[model samples]
Every structure is written in structure tokens, then in C-alpha cells.
Target: MGMKASYVVQPFELHRKRLRPARQEAAQSESGALKKAENLAKRMPGAAALRIVADDETGELESATILEAFGEVPDDFAESLQGG
Candidate 1:
């Protein structure tokens, strides 16, 4: 088994006074994810850069981290990312 790391940009939208996730995008690197999230935040309610680590063979999540958050992100964004 091997561990794999991934970077992703998640954009958020406000709906009925709630922050909801929009389409998610994969990034080549952490910096790329951060840049993408920052750009998306301009036109979105919020955006976040995430780093996720998991087992490649089992597809089990090892951890999820919020690298950065832009604009009006959810108050429980970090907890949500951790599947809490």
C-alpha cells in the first residue's frame, strides 16, 4: 500500500443564506490549488485550497487539510473537510 497526496480547489456559493460547495477542481500542485482558489473566490462566494492524503490501494482517507481559504468560507469548513 502507498499513500498519495492530492491538491484541490473547492469553490463555494451562497444559497438561501447557506454556504454550499460548487464544482471542485484538481490542481497539479499546492501552489496551483491556492492560485486557482484565489481566482475563483473573485467570482464565487468563497473558495478554498485543500491538501488530501489517502491510501492509494484502499482509497481510505488519511487526512484532509485546508491549505488556505478565500473570501466568505463556511464556519465549519475545516471540520467538514475532516469529515467531522
Candidate 2:
């Protein structure tokens, strides 16, 4: 084999056997994230209550007094954390 050909296959062929576990782990992590998304979607339709807590007056967090539909998350979800 030529020098370039041998070098090209070195890392790939060497790591071929190790790819399975790494791929499996990535797949498992993706599956878990998908499951969480599905669960949240399922709970969305019945989300009738939300508690907004603003600990600082300087914070721009605001609470919603009306919802046109269910599962409506406030835009200030992350802003609410700024108070702390």
C-alpha cells in the first residue's frame, strides 16, 4: 500500500470497532431527549395552570392574565430566573 492510502485508513479502521458503543450512546441520548419532548407534548393540552414568580422589581418578568389556547408558556420563562 502507498503511504497516503495507509494513513487515510489508519484512524478510521482503527476506530471502526469502537464506533458501535459511541454510536449507541449518542442514539440513547437522542432517544431520551425525544421521550422528554413527547411527554411534554402530551402534558401540553391539559396545562391549565402556571405560577409566575418574580423576585425582583428590576426584572422584566411579566405574568399572563389570558390565554387564547392551552399549553401557552409565558415569554418570560427565562426572564423569571433573572430575579434570582
- State every prediction's TM-score relative to the real structure: 0.94, 0.24
lDDT tens string, model 2, 1-84? 111100000001114323111111111233343343334435442111222323354443344221111233344433443443
Which pairs clash inside model 1?
A: none
**Cα lDDT for residue 59, model 2?**
44
| Cα lDDT listed for each candidate | 0.93, 0.26
Output the number of the lDDT-best candidate: 1
Candidate 1 residue lDDT tens string, 19-39: 999999999999999999999
Judged by whole-model lDDT over C-alpha atoms, candidate 2 comes out at 0.26
Q: Which portions of model 1 show Cα errors greater than 4 Å?
A: none
Provide the lowest-lDDT 10-residue window in model 1. 75-84
**True-structure RMSD, every candidate:** 1.0, 22.7
TM-score of 1: 0.94
